[model samples]
Target chain A: MVKVVRNVVCPFCGTLCDDLEILVEDNHIVGTRHACRIGNAKFMHFEGAVRYTEPLMRENKKDDFKKVDYETAIEETARLLTEAALPLIYGWSATECHAHMYGVELAELVGAVIDNTASV
Target chain B: MQDVGYPVCTLGEVKNRADVVIYWGSNPMHAHPRHMSRYSVFARGFFRERGREDRTLIVVDPRETDSAKLADIHLQVEPHKDYELISAMRAVLKGFELQTDKVAGVPADLIYEAVEICKNAQFGQLYFAMGVTMTRGKHRNIDNAISLVIDLNAYTKFGLMPMRGHYNVNGFNQVLTWVTGYPFGVDFSRGYPRYNPGETTANDLLQRGETDMMLNIASDPGAHFPQKAVQHMAKIPLVCIDPHETPTTQLANIIIPPAIAGVEVEGTAYRMDGVPIQLRKVIDPPEGVLPDREILKMLIKKVKEML
Candidate 1:
């Protein structure tokens, strides 16, 4: 079964073509219409089977990455940020403003600088 | 983001009144497939009488692109010679011939023909992208392209805009400018806005080995940046915040999977031409996985408490 959702904007490029018709079935984006090749690829792979659904950790004592609890991972990250003298928090081109503001606030709290994909 | 003033118009205006559409150094067919079908060729606008039949399409590039194949006129100039061709076109429009019979590998006749097309159009729109901005003499190439449009105003109503990349790239530039007083590369390490592209740009700093730790959000520098920059990223303690798996994820010490903006999360984004639009969610993300802002907000609180 297919249900076409209309006027879906493509978030890939700056064109932001909003007349897209997505074919959804069982919460999976089965197909799309009125979009470019890039948009199709992005939509087609929206739900990745290999996504990291849990917090991961590569602690100094451990030789390999270990799946850890979310709170533990956050605490580890906070510990690292607190220790680093001049951290570089970067990459914000694909996110929203509220998130970018949070990133900035995090960077500022640590007296660290922030950049974006524009820099790289 | 510069203070340079130029003629500006919305995409709606292009659809409504533009009789001649010029794609310079861009292949919208591959880059922006629906641009022609929606805005220039097939849009049922107020004055466009018969869709594509009422308009003329022109393409200018060093090599023929997929989009150029559909052009009524294609000016295939030499690579790294766009500045010369643009200057020559400007000179021709002002009723002057090039000192050489051929300039930028294009014959005098072809130059004149392109000049004629630009001059005769009732409402012409020039859309250019990285071709003019990324090559040698980048700024000069843009200056000449803008100058050509400015010159064309004498004969016809013309507007030109950069084919900006990314749905919200302009949004970052706009928002950063409004809040921080500078566009892309703004530094606040000193607790104030410090603006300098070369000095503060990501790759430059990475190449120079300036940063100790790197937190990458929503962008994959490992995939797009040079191997040297990526190598630098690998050496540092890297953190990634994105929805999908990319090469950057491989080097990341911490990979935070945030809810996909415009997909699992709703927010506002700025289009290439500075038009703001709201993004609607199509589905829910994984349970407990929050939006980018929420995740960052979590880190902000933790980082602040630690600080």
Candidate 2:
């Protein structure tokens, strides 16, 4: 059965249109109503082949990434951040507010320079 | 506008009462497809009963964009001349005659007519985007535009708003301001938050290779940043957390995929007009995939332990 969810806010763009009706069937998005072409594309094409579903890691810039567990990924990330002299935390425009709060906390903990898309 | 102060209002006010709508250097027809129909031009409101018929649309752009085509009057200004155009509008609003026949490639007569339309409006709105902010003058153009709106207030009601990009960009600013007392380019290096735009901003720091590691959340700087910044980002250790595979993700040393916000995860996002709205989750994310907040929280905890 397709469940119709009304008043769904679009994640794409700053308009944040909150009157969309999303049709979901078996955990898959089927259709969207009252969304623009961009919003509709965002909702419909979320689970495409291009989407990354698992954590990945690479030792060098030129090396291909290998699939890793969340714990290992987080540990490596923490090690890198803790070891670095100056770290930059950027890109908070696409996510939610709670995520931004955590980002700020992490930046504070690591004494990193925090910024958003507003600068550029 | 730190000096002159900006006169602005909610999109609700624009929808209800704006009679003269100006799109200066913004192509909403393409960038914001439903903005006109939903809020500004076609939306029927309490006072705007006739909707588009009741409003006069004016588009000021160097190129004839689709939005310009729909405007009642399209002022084709010269590129990187928005500051001059705004200055001319301000001067004309103050009852001063232009020394030149044309200002910023727009005729002086058209400027006078546009000023007349704006001066006579019950409620006027000016919406601008990258066309002005990313141009040669940058924030100076915005500052001048704000001054023009302030000048228009002497004759009538006028409000201005930036056509902000990104769904939660304003939310980030609001959150950062309330939490750390700074909007963006905040440095926590001294164990406290400090803001200095030119010195601490992301682009400036990255271009100067001041940062050794980068933690990128939901935005793609590789696709949008300057070549120098991207080059530095490529040379450093990048940890990217995003749902989609973007250019930034390709440059990451650790790619942690998160559930799509406002899709698989319910959260709060601020609209362009600084209105906070709740985003609903319509579907479940892939197995074991977490939201950005969850992943960020875990990282924070792990980093705290390491420190």
Candidate 3:
């Protein structure tokens, strides 16, 4: 059986069209209506496409990226930033304001510079 | 975007009151597919009877876009000649006669007809897009358009608005303004908010090869920035934080995928017209995954501990 959800805000684009309906079956969106072509594809057809599901790490550029546990990846990233003389943080178009504020805090602690896609 | 301020109207207000609508360098059918059906021509409003028929539509662009086909008056402009066309229209509005046979490939008579509609309308709206702002004259083109609308106000009610692209560009501008006293390109390295566009803007810094390491938030600059900027970004160590995979991630040394906002997670976002709406989340994120704010908080904790 399919569960119908009405007024699903489109997760795609800036229109924020709040009248779309979605059909969820087995935890996957199988259908959508009242959404534009762009929104429909984003809501209903994202899976089956390639999605990176786990953290990946490469040992200093010579080796291919290997799937690492999230803890290992986060700690490794933190250590790199803590040790680096200069670090920069960029790209934040999808995150919310609270996240950006948190990002600012993190940047301050790491002594890194932060920028977003808007500048580009 | 300019030094001068112009009258602004919402899509709902325009639908309710406007009888004359002008689209400058914008195609809703291609760029904003649902704009017509939701707000402009197709929607039934308080005053708009027979939907699209109640409005006199004008489309001015170098190309005949899908949206132009619906216009009562369509002017196919000469590429990079928007300034001349707009200036000619403003002159005609101010009672000056055009001496040239044609200005910007548009006949003077058509300009007269557009002016006539503007002068006669009860309510008029002129909407512009990136085509005017990103072109040769840039700010000058917008200045002319705003002045044209201001002149129209003497004859009838008029307002001008940019058909802002992206769902939250205007919202971001509003938030940034509220937080930092500036809209974008804010630098805080001195522990103070300092805004300098050419020096601090992402592409400018990248082009100058000044950015050493980049913490890319939710945006994908690699796909959109100019080639020179992208070349420099490719040389730097980069981090990507997004819900989905993009070309930027392909070039990223670190990719931190967060739960999709407005979908897997909920937040407040402002509309194109500066109206705020709270997004409703239907389902939780995949187990072990978290909202972007939470992830950022985790990073903050980790960084502080490192300190």
Candidate 4:
């Protein structure tokens, strides 16, 4: 069955043109309208990239990202972050406000240097 | 104040109604590709049926950029002399004589011509960028731009807007102002909001080696920062949260893949002009992956447990 969604906002840019219309078929966005070039590119982001379906971990300075279980990988990641004396948390440009709020808390606990893409 | 500053309008209003559009240091073609098409010259509007014809385009920059090529008046000002140029314009607007043969790269005659254009416009808007903010004088340049707009308002309706890069940089500033009672690049390590752009800025901290660990979210300092700052980032324990692989991610100790904002997640982001817009989710994220909000929540929970 086909579905028509209305009043979709393109969050790629700050313009946030809220006139995007998406046509979905079989759980896929088959058609889009009123979106800019970047917006359309964002919609088709996964079409041409090799997706990382499994969790990856690297213990040494090698390009060896062993496929680890999700919990194991996350735990290790958390351990590395918590152990660091000064950790810089950047790249919040694409994240949501909810994530940014949580990020503030995490940075405070670790006393880490939290910065977004804007610093660059 | 809606955090940083309020009473801002979208670029849409500027294109449709503004008779004068000033591009001060912003190369919109490289940064905002759609800005010129949708909000500046090409877009057909009510009063501006002949888009480019109805509006006056002024490109004030240090170089003859691609945007400058499309401008009616291109003021190729000297790099980092934005304060002097703006001060000169203000002085001319206030009926004062320029003491020097030149201010920036433009002559006194050109400065007066620019001021006359600004003062005579029915509605004028200044859209500036990092070129003004990252130069030698920094915030002082911004002060001049703002004060010039104030002076222009004496004759006509005039406004100014910073061409914020990220979609949510103004959002960050807004949130910071609410939480810490300050604007962008604010530091709370001193138990209060302390904002000093160069001193507390990311580049200076990384250069001086004051920061030990760095957590970089959705940003890539390695690509844009100076060599010294990039070197510091490479040596630090960096945590990168982004969808794409970047130079910063290559050196990161923990690389967290986040659900793309506005696509797989929903949130609020402030526009360049301080307008808050809602980002709606269109689809689910990767099977095992979480949105940035969810990832942060998980990290926060783990950190609290450790504490």
Query: Which lDDT tens digits does candidate 3 get at residues B1-307?
Result: 4456668878888878888888899988877788777777777789986778888999998888898998999988888788998888889889999998789999888988988998899898898887787678866788888888888888889988777565555555666667667666766666676677667677777888877777676777878888998888778766666666777777767666677777677787666666666766766667776677876776677777877
lDDT of 4 at B4: 29
Give the DockQ-based CAPRI class for model 4. acceptable
Interface RMSD of each candidate, angstroms, one decimal: 2.0, 0.8, 2.5, 2.5
Candidate ordering by lDDT (highest first): 2, 1, 3, 4
Error of 4 at A5 (Å): 4.9
Worst 10 residues of 3 chain A by lDDT: A111-120
Note the residue pairs that clash in candidate 2. none
Most lDDT-accurate candidate: 2
Q: Report, for candidate 2, the interface RMSD.
A: 0.8
Least well predicted 10-residue stretch by lDDT in candidate 4 chain B:
B1-10
Docking class of 1: medium
B201 Cα displacement, candidate 4 (Å): 2.5
Best by DockQ: 2
Off by over 4 Å in 1: A1-3, A46-49, A59-63, A79-86, A111-113, A117-120, B1-3
Second chain TM-score for model 2: 0.97
* DockQ, structure candidate 1: 0.57
Judge candidate 1 against the unseen true structure and give its global Cα lDDT, from 0 to 1.
0.78
- Following a full C-alpha superposition, what root-mean-square deviation does model 1 have from the true structure? 2.7
Q: Is candidate 2 or candidate 3 better by lDDT?
A: 2
Q: Please name the candidate that would achieve the greatest TM-score relative to the true structure.
A: 2
